[model samples]
Target: MPTLEDRLRNCTRSAVHLEMRDEYMPSDPRFTAWRNGARNDPADSDPERRPWLRLVADLVAQGVEVRRARIVSEPVSDYIRFEHHLTVPTVRAGEQVRWLPRRRASGLALPGNDFWLFDGTSVVFHHFAGDGELAPDDEEFTDDPVVVKLCSDAFESVWRQAVPHADYTLA
Candidate 1:
């Protein structure tokens, strides 16, 4: 039962994340600040200010390909907008990001929950409450071949159709 950080740190080849929720961590301080008009400074490079950036950068440096794709609804939620605005540093850190409008995903088979696939073998599913807060005992990890293949296939399908972050615009 390794932690997410542990799994990430040990990841050797590739790590792909699929985000299907319209909102997450609704009460996160960063989201709150963004709601109030505060914005992330794209120029800010301090790891203390954006530790996730540091982690992704380190992984990329280690030759681990890190990628994330978000399936979002049209006329996106404020949270999505906030995430998009702050994604510059993430892109700069070396993770390839993409966004697929949920409508376009209607024909694709997708996992019920969002997840992270590590090296195409392991999967960590994330559970969230109605309020967009992570549920208690929030994560489920599995190495089952069926589940792993399902997630891996779903992610690749999404990635292939998704628009790169730099090219996506809020609808």
Candidate 2:
């Protein structure tokens, strides 16, 4: 099986990520800083500080349309708030992002987990623990059309109702 990085590197057309977790690893340094009242300067001059930015920019240069959607509970978690504020760099790197309040997500038949769909042909499902930390070595990738289509459909549904990051505000 190809690594996620390999899949991403080889992806053509579109790459979409759907994040459905309220909290990820609280121990991550960035999250820790946010918890300590630090703010993210989306306009920070240094863009290459993060490698993902380079990868995203490269993909965009290749005409790959990258997008991400998040489903979060209202009265949002602190981590979600942090992530919301940090999306600017992502947009600057040539990706579109949206946010969907979980309340608005009811009745949708979403997948059991969050996933990244590449070129609408492959999926990488993220598995997490009960406390919301990612499980070790838990990324499951598949090329099965049925699963891919289900994820594609679910993502589109959420994307349609989701608010663009620039317009989204925590309530």
Candidate 3:
């Protein structure tokens, strides 16, 4: 039997991750219901997904590169993981990963497929292919720079529209 570490290595090295927006629901038949809501907002994180993070951590230990991008409501907390997820591996075995956190200042935009992420290099969507297999509401990217640029422009537009999470925090 392969040890947990070995299994993780295999997964990390050969995993076609399905990027899901924060509103992706794996068990809902309705078109409106997503994976989970505010309390279950894994857009930034969750307990169930921690294993994947651990896997990435392991891969980093073995000189594997991981690129992760998330549309987080509060980018501050998620930024904490960028180092552990990307940098450590680079040092361990010359592995490098990019953890890009696109802060989504909540309440401004609905928690659905309102937006996608295009950080100049990648066009990450929500949910690659699985239980809820479907194209993004905004199907523009089709081997055209215009499509990706549109996504990036949309990101910046949303970014400018969104308010700082700390703006509404209780002191």
Candidate 4:
């Protein structure tokens, strides 16, 4: 028989026993997929990702005095009108707001298989293994998945490359 490591390295279609979940809660034990998105990628997009809507509603609901920044740009440039609802607040909702300045900022680095996002909650870092290997169970995963580790390292490198936020004048 092949070594256990070899068997686990190619977990292309295996399932692990785990707690019942939302069936799409991400972090599912048996899910074997990866992509370039936030650390928290729901099977369907979540409204919580729309920080702009939450901000506006929160401002009106809580009536917290809001000084705003109104510049939002996505280097990917893939967000649509519905997504823009959140993009606006993400662009404008903080005492200290900063957007990822990839295509615009001077000295921006090359795109890698990693991304970092801060939503005034905590810094979330995402690293994807572009080598296209499926992630095995934490209990069963083997191969050290060095490509994924490298992706995580690349995320740290880019986080260091981030520029400080500048206030928007909202012209």
Candidate 5:
């Protein structure tokens, strides 16, 4: 199977990601630094510092629409707040990001895990441990039509209702 970056690089139309967890990678250096009061400049554009920016920018430059929708709880978790703070560069890289309050997602049928759907065809699910750490062999990929459709529909539903990241204020 191709690597996630390889799949993303090959995307011809779109790449969408749905993040349902409020906390992830509790021990991530960036998040740890944020917790210690080290703040990142949202306008910082050093690709080496944030590799995701490079990847997303490359995809967008190729006309592949990249988007991310996060479903978060109200009175957000510290991690979510940190994620919000770090999102500017991502948006600037051409990925449309939105936030949907968990309360507002009550009626939607969503998958059990976070996933990246590429070109409306393949899905990469991210599995994590209870402590918010990514489990070993964390990624699971599938091209099943039913799963692809489920993810596609769920993402669109959240995207339609989620507030653009620019307009969302931390609660």
Candidate 6:
């Protein structure tokens, strides 16, 4: 099986990420630091310091439109607030981001898991545990047309209703 990096590298047109969880990877050092009131310097775009930012930058440079949408619960979690604060560099790196309050997502048929859809073809599902940590054997990737269509449609639906990151606030 091709690695996720390999798949992403081969993506030509778009890479869309849909994130629905309120909290993620609590044990992650970055989150831990945020929990302690630490904040990321918006001026820091050093790929060495943040590899994911590097990836998003490279993909955008390649003309791959990278976008992310988060459906968050209102009275947002601390982690979500921290993520919003850190999103500046991510947007500056060229990834478009939006936030959707979960209450507004009532009628949409969303997927069971968060996922990244590449070029409308491949999908990478992120499974998480009850505590919101990534599942032990997480990252599931597939090219099934059915799953791809569902995720693609779901993402678009959410994106259309989401607020652009800069305008969103925890309510």
TM-score of 6: 0.94
Residue-level lDDT of model 1, residues 1-171, one tens digit each, is 788888999999999999999999999987888899886554345667778889999999999999999999999999999999888888989999999999999999999999999999999999999899999979999999999999999999999999999999899
Clashing pairs in 1: none
TM-score of each: 0.96, 0.94, 0.31, 0.25, 0.96, 0.94
lDDT ranking from best candidate downward = 5, 1, 6, 2, 3, 4
Q: What TM-score does candidate 4 get on C-alpha atoms?
A: 0.25
Error of 3 at 11 (Å): 19
What is the per-residue lDDT of model 6 for residues 1-171, given as tens digits with 9 covering 90 to 100? Answer: 777778788999999999999998888777787789776654356677888788888999999999999999989998898788788888988999999999999999999999999999989999999998888988998889999999999999999999998898778
Model 4: per-residue Cα lDDT over 3-118, one tens digit each:
32233222332211111111222343323333233333442234376444454344434433322211234432323122332334443433222233333434432333222222
The TM-score of candidate 3 is: 0.31
Task: Report lDDT (CA) for all predictions.
Answer: 0.93, 0.88, 0.37, 0.31, 0.93, 0.89
TM-score (C-alpha) between model 1 and the true structure: 0.96
* Residues 32-88 of candidate 5: C-alpha lDDT, one tens digit per residue: 888899886543466777788999999999999999999999999999999998888
Runs in model 4 lying further than 4 Å from the true structure? 1-98, 103-143, 163-171
Candidate closer to the true structure by lDDT (higher is better), 1 or 6? 1
After best superposition, candidate 6 residue 65: deviation in angstroms?
0.3
For residue 159, what is the lDDT in candidate 6?
Answer: 96
Q: Write the per-residue lDDT of candidate 2 for residues 1-171, one digit (tens) a residue.
A: 777778888988999999998998887787888789877544332466766777889899999999999999999999898887777887888989999999999988899999999999889999988887779977998989999999999999999999999999898
Candidate ranking under TM-score, highest first, comes to 1, 5, 6, 2, 3, 4
- Which residue ranges in model 2 land beyond 4 Å of their true spot? 41-45
Query: Candidate 2's error at 160, in angstroms?
Result: 0.6
Model 3, span 1-171: residue lDDT tens: 434344335543322121224333433332222212222334324324445455555665665444332343333332232323233323333222222234433433232343333234333334233433444542322325664556555545444543332233211
